[model samples]
Target: MTTRRNFLKGVGASGIAFCSCGMLDAARAQGAAPRSTPVMVKGKRIKTVDVHAHCLFHESLNLLGTEEAAKVLPPTKGVPEHFIVIEQRLKEMDAMGIDMEILSINPFWYNRERDLAAQIVKVNNEKLAELCAANPSRFGAFASLTLQVPDLAVQQLEDAVKKQGLRGAAIGASVMGQDFSDPKFHPVWAKAEELGAVLFIHPQSTPQLAQRFKGNGWLSNTIGNPLDTTIALQHLIFEGTLDRFPKLKVIAAHGGGFLPSYAARGDHACFVSPQNCNAEIQLKKKPSEYLNQLYFDAMVFTPEGLRHLAAQVGASQLMLGTDHPIPWEQHPVDHVFATDTLSDEQMAAILGGNAARLFGLKEV
Candidate 1:
């Protein structure tokens, strides 16, 4: 049972704190007490794995030049620097009881020139591989791709996984303003399917919604981020990309966004307006049928939210994900453990079992 007190303890007051003021104040109030670690289950230590962790690539920043990188990245204090120190990261992981984290850099160079994008991809992949190599047991990585140039993206994926030992690739929900469902991205999808790479779809705040999201609250991240992911997943489902690449191991960040909560609407839409639904791209299954084919992270931040996600997508398809280096869900393993809805087996699987199989982790 996840009581409100337990939830607040695991995530701090920041768990329920939505606005910037609340977050900032909560950080100051919480002080520097270490978080409680994951508990032992059945006399065994649960091997916790976080599939949605992020890292900064300083080399890429240097390549892009400070001015260019600053434009794309958020103007946060000590971001890339905070994530770069290996000792600091390991200490935090140990405190949180996370045995491993699959690192990824959300695509920020998607709109850059082909050559610049390729170079950024190369540098990011190399740095990530190096980090994983240094901390083989504690860290794994997803390669960054130049999706604006699909052919280059495909080649980069192959090289990254085969040669670099990267687990998969991390991509944004969209390329510039273009959705993943666009035919131009087919080659990249096909290559990912063939390689059996885990394509992690993370969102960069949806630019189209900037005007609407601007205000005192961080609606851009609170609403815009998940909204972007929702749009991307819908396109993939309705536009036949999932049907085309059924075997692609795709993981949607932020608990598959709003899709899981309102998936039945897709089925209703198809049935109600068959003419609006493309017959050429007619899905062999209902739009919601694809939910089971995809995977989601347990970053919803509440027991009820996580329970709803599990019901929609099943426990087997849900993995522990903490948008790390960010203060969201500080104690991720504990958050999953706090959920009373999941059985001990289901809990174990979400914490690490599923990720071990998906990423081919030998340690588990």
Candidate 2:
């Protein structure tokens, strides 16, 4: 009974709140944001790793061939490709109590032709690695890959982890309009599992929903971004992509978008309306079970918001995240600390231990 008009009509006040609530929360957090580092849990200092931080190298942007159009700065929030000032970054990290940050450049070259995409990948991955090297104690990075070409993406992932010393690769929710659940991208997933590289999934705004996302609260990002991530994750789960590569290490941004918020619905969809669910692709585990193997960031805006997310995904699956330089999360450390339900040990892990174990990072 879901019609195009009905779906369009659904984007009403709730859609506006979907984007506005986070801003409201951010405004509240600004007054309480931390001013120094050395975050402690149980009276002991612990390192904090922000796995969901983003960046874009200016050199990589040069390949696009126009000064103004080169850097893809969204009107809502952005970390400029040209301005990753090390001193300023460290100062910000100190305030956030982040001991180390694993940086990544969200994929902006997926639409480029193969050759240009490869060049962009080369520049981005190499520059990120160089940054980590220069600030070994304070920085780590996820590499960039040309996922539009799976064979090349495999090589890029291998070289990035083995040679350039990147922890993993950051990817967009989809390539152009192609779903990653399609077998075409299987090689990249297989290679990532083979190399033990983490595949960080970041969502670009859902351009298809642009018509409905207009006017206000930066709905393109608030609603579109999370919706983009939600669709990508559901496809991977229901389409058997997670079953196909069970060992593949994956992480989802923005608290796995809206999926975790309503994951129980995934378990019920096939039974309630088998007609809409795919019959050809059978998932090995219950739809909700796939989430157990996946990772998520603590980008939700409030302590209760985070506490509820942890209840759904388990505290072990959650790690610190700040869509930094973009003002999305002003007090990521304090946000985690404020989760009253979490024990001291769980707090330590969420602060940084979980990320260190996943990325093999040493405590600072």
Worst 10 residues of 1 by lDDT: 14-23
Q: 1-364, model 1: which lDDT tens digit per residue?
A: 4443454464564332212221334544765234434444433556678899888777787888878867766655336533578887776676666778899988888878999888889999999999999999999999999999999999999999899999989999999889999999999989888889999999987899899998977988889889899999999999988998989899999998889999999889967888787778778798898999899999999888988999999998989887776767776765676677887778878888888888887534
Query: Which regions of candidate 2 fall more than 4 Å away from where they truly are?
Result: 1-33, 67-71, 76-82
- TM-score of every model? 0.89, 0.89
Q: Write the per-residue lDDT of candidate 2 for residues 214-324, one digit (tens) a residue.
A: 997888889888998999999999999998899888899999999998999889999999999879978888998888889999999988898898889888898988877
Q: What lDDT would each prediction earn against the true structure?
A: 0.81, 0.81
lDDT at 301, model 2: 91
List ranges where model 1 is wrong by over 4 Å: 1-39, 76-82
